[model samples]
Target: MKEVYITKISKFLPNRPISNDEMEDKLGIINGKASKGRRIVLRNNQIKTRYYALDDDGNVTHNNAQLAKEAIEQLFDENFTSSDIDLLSCGTSSPDQILPSHAAMVHGFLKCDNVEINSPSGACCSGMNALKFGFLSVKSGQTNNAIASGSERISSWMKGHIFENEIKHLQALEDNPILAFNKDFLRWMLSDGAGAFLLENEPNGETPLRIEWMEGYSYAHELEACMYAGGDKLENGFLKPWSEYKTSDWSEKSLFAIKQDVKLLSANILKKGVDSLKRALTKHDLKPSEIDYYLPHISSHFFKDKLYQEMVDNGVEIPWENWFMNLSKVGNVGSASIFLMLEELAHSGKLKKGQKILLSVPESSRFSYAYALLTVC
Candidate 1:
């Protein structure tokens, strides 16, 4: 198998840091809510919240399609695009369409006829699975050069009615505000993001990273825990999903269930990840202690606990002391979690040659998907 290398990566976040305090003030979150662990806090205060970036014209710019284009454009500029890129993949949840796929949407923007595109919809695991497929494809010589971009549009998931219902519980207190600023954060913590990477086969020049090998395992039983049941937006964007006649039943079931679904799914996903890694490395007799860096999905703050527990159960030694949290600051970021982490590491100049990075992804629709080890060389 030919070695597939991650030659370059880039991330484009909306400028202007939105601090927790600022977010609370702007969104009207209060002391009781703040003290009740209602707000999502980032350990790194220097980290900024990411959002949809608008052009100077301020047009609520860049739907999912445009966002993909801008993200890829920045990545190409940062790493230098080549007309020779063999394959392009878009890993996304907010796909532009269910038919042609978001991969083709990005391909259309790039306007490259030479490359084949595939959009994978593995929910939050889109980034990991897409890149793993790219690496595996390159290893098999199907392509020498490839690009993977992971983008999420959590804004689309924000329904006004849902937001209103969630905030109604706050009792319209001007001083007592919403949790996590009492906006959409109360319903969901994951935010929006777009991250891209350029991968090549056999780096002929100076390179700091290479994808050594990758493998994934799937658990399909837990799909119900996280789901998007197709909102009421018509294709023409006319009728609202909930605009149909009101139902007769009027019961006050909690607007949201605090059931431990994400938490449970996190534990299950991490457990499967450990098993998959052990099985993959057992083929070459490697262990967790041999890894240099570990990058896993930051679904929620509790994810770290799940990872630690899984490592302990698997008897795997994790060399991570960095807490390595990103969920709250950028929200969940769905498919962009691992890829964005790599982009951040590259931005900070921390990714060095001869290091091993272990990546695992916990997804929504796809249950759990993970990668073993990708050596940097």
Candidate 2:
């Protein structure tokens, strides 16, 4: 098998940065009332600014596929174009449509020649899955070059009108007048963006990051859903999928809105993540001292200290100085977050040859985790 190198990295963060004060303006007030949980979520997430694909009028400016397409365009130059790509792998929790896969839609927009395409669906780990697929394809000599992307266009779903039906239903039942915290909180937490990575058999740029290895693990068998959309969780810990619900029940129950069991996430997310990291390190015979940079995909600053303590408890401590994170500036772009962080660090000019970088992503959807080791060459 051959080696795979990440020759280029790029990101598209949609329109201008939206500050905490401007978030509700972009996403709009739900049920014509301000959110009570917005400030708390923003404070915990510590996201100072983020981008959205919507204009001031709450109209979508770019769909999910377009965001991925724009990011992919940044990878091309006079030497390489879309036609040079042998495989396209895209991952997104919020695709523009349900029928056509995200990669298929992106390919239609690129207008490039036919090539192998893959669309991996999930939460944050979806992006890492796409990256892994591209890596294995190139390493196995199935393709000479590949483009992997992670993107989300969830702003449209978070708009105020999307929840009007649910608000009315709750009011009719004399239930809680506001949207549930599980669904309302996410409106302030997530933003829109896309990021892409160019992989090849040989390094193309002046400083290439070689993919040493990638590892992933899931605890779904032992855990129930922690974060979800297009469904509701039952008392028995089963997720009643959207397909089982009637059309009217969809909006009435806000089944499409992103929801999180905060208690469940707080309990297992970090512990499971650190456990997976330990296993990956053991499998690869690596040590914390060998890592020069640590890029962790944390959804909020709330988990920053907790994650550190978890690592310390597990005896795999990577000091704070070695960490690199852009969650404050970019918000949680979901699956695209890891790619966006890599794009920033790869172009930051701080990397040196032979320095090792570790990437970690934890998906609370079902307590899944992914880790990767890269070396600057």
Candidate 3:
């Protein structure tokens, strides 16, 4: 197999850091029923600060494709240009437009006429799928140069905070405000960012990472309705388009609306994630003991212990210190998370040449998982 390597990695986050306190205030979460809901999310999730592409009044500042284009531009040097890229795979959950596809828009924005574009839309692990496409294309000699990128504009979701009247109604229905308004919590947890990787078939010199093996898995059938958007799963196991939902409930319908089964996610994410990684290691004939670093794209700190225990149960035995994360610093950038984590780790000056590293991404949406093994070179 032709070896593929990532020559450079870049990340773009909109605006400055916005603290949780600021978000709570700006979203109008005062001493109302939503206040307890906001407090629960802030106290449970370890995110102190996150980046948003929003103005002072909470209006969208940049669209999804623009954020992705900026990140890809940062990857280019004097020797690289849009024309040098033969393939562009864009992964995004928040697309600026649906008809043109985010990747195609990016290709046009970059003014590239000959690049093949593919947008792996949906779910958080969609970004890893985009990277896998680029890696496979280069490794197979189908394309010499490819860029895999993940970008999200989830701050747009924050603009549509649940109305005060609705919050009052939900609070009346349940004693726990968090449980009553679970979807509202996602707005606070997810953030806006873009991360990109430039892949080449041949390594000109020492690079950040050389792709060894990449594998992705999905158990959507088994964990159906665990996480979803665009539609809601009914009690009968059929997804009903939100447009068809009656009762004047605009609260459950929006371009950025997302529904999640928290019970299923908290129960299955770690076990399935660990299993997927173990399978990848076995397929590549790799040993967990040899991995120098483990980079994980996790949305919350609550899952850290669960994943650690899962890894221990699976016999990987990697210490907590070996796993690097940027969730607290960047929040959950959705599809862009893996690339952002990788970028942070590469620039942290901790990795050494010839060291082996593992990158893992687990998505609640569709219950998908991906693992990549790389060597610092």
Candidate 4:
């Protein structure tokens, strides 16, 4: 099979910096009197800011098409134009898309008539999934160059009319819709931002990084673990839904051959993923000692420790004390985390040639995605 190369990566984190401290202060004020039952522990600022496409009122943005345009511009700045792109994919949940795919809007706005474009929807993992899909398409001799990127204005997920009850319960949120429930999830644990990459069949010129390989699989049962509004009706191959009769505890759900508990889940999933990667390594004749760095799609600091323990439990060895770090400074950016890590590695000169890299995606309550990508030789 032919190989696909990742030519370059660009990230667009907004100028607005919302640190954990900032969020905590805002939350304390936002939920002051009524959020006694809602609990969240914030990072002592171990996490930092994330970008946003704000409205004129300095609030979270609702114009997704504009954000999409800005993301594309930021990704290819000082480099590409409409003429250079052949395939464009926009993986997003929010876009100025009422009638057409957001990618089509971008294509029309850029006035690039020759390129093929698509908009993929899968929520947080959408951008990463789009990238691997494009990689396979290229490797299968379908396209030569592709642009894969995504943006999330999670701010829009809020609805004023829907939260009237919650606001009524809380005195601090009399003026605004305070996200008390998600505060625990957001704490220093996550942030909001966007990033993109320009993938090519071959990299030349000033391209900072080159692709190696991208592989994926579906754990259907696992997919049924984490889900939302349209979770049960999942018909597309994109999502892993939470089981129809899912209960409160993570363990009660039948993993079948899989065990329960967060630790066991991490160990088991990591073991399976590493086994697949081991097969890939055997096919390529590589080893763990050969991998200089590891980039994991982390969702929580707790899982970070659990993952490390699982690596030891599964007997996978490596020197990753510094390798498996999270972007705690910026929070978790969903599917954008891995790509953002790739951008960071390349720009910081941490992603060197002939290096084997391992990236394990976090548990989405459904499935955990893992991959083994090698740096250009």
The candidate that wins on TM-score is: 2
**Which residue runs of candidate 2 sit more than 4 Å off their true CA positions?**
none
Ranking by TM-score: 2, 3, 1, 4
Pick the lDDT winner.
Answer: 2
Question: Mind giving the per-residue lDDT tens digits that candidate 3 earns over 127-233?
Answer: 99899999989999999989999999876655445444445555677644342354666767788989999999777544558999888898877877676666667
lDDT of 1 at 275: 70
- Model 4 bad stretches (over 4 Å): 24-39, 44-46, 55-58, 61-65, 75-79, 93-99, 158-162, 166-190, 227-286, 322-326, 363-365, 370-372
lDDT of each: 0.60, 0.94, 0.80, 0.56
lDDT of 3 at 271: 85
Error of 4 at 270 (Å): 6.3
Lowest lDDT 10-residue stretch of candidate 2: 24-33
Predicted structure 3, TM vs. truth: 0.91
Compose the digit string of candidate 1's lDDT tens values, residues 280-336.
667757776777777777555555676687777777757666334565456567787
Name the weakest run of 10 consecutive residues (lDDT summed) in model 3: 247-256
lDDT of 4 at 187: 27
* Model 3 local distance difference test score: 0.80
lDDT of 3 at 332: 89
Angstrom error at residue 55, model 4? 6.5
lDDT by residue for model 2 (273-323), tens? 999999999999999999999999999999999999999999999999999
> TM-score of model 1 relative to the true fold?
0.75
Which runs of model 1 end up more than 4 angstroms from their true locations? 21-48, 53-59, 77-82, 159-187, 204-206, 221-225, 231-270, 322-325
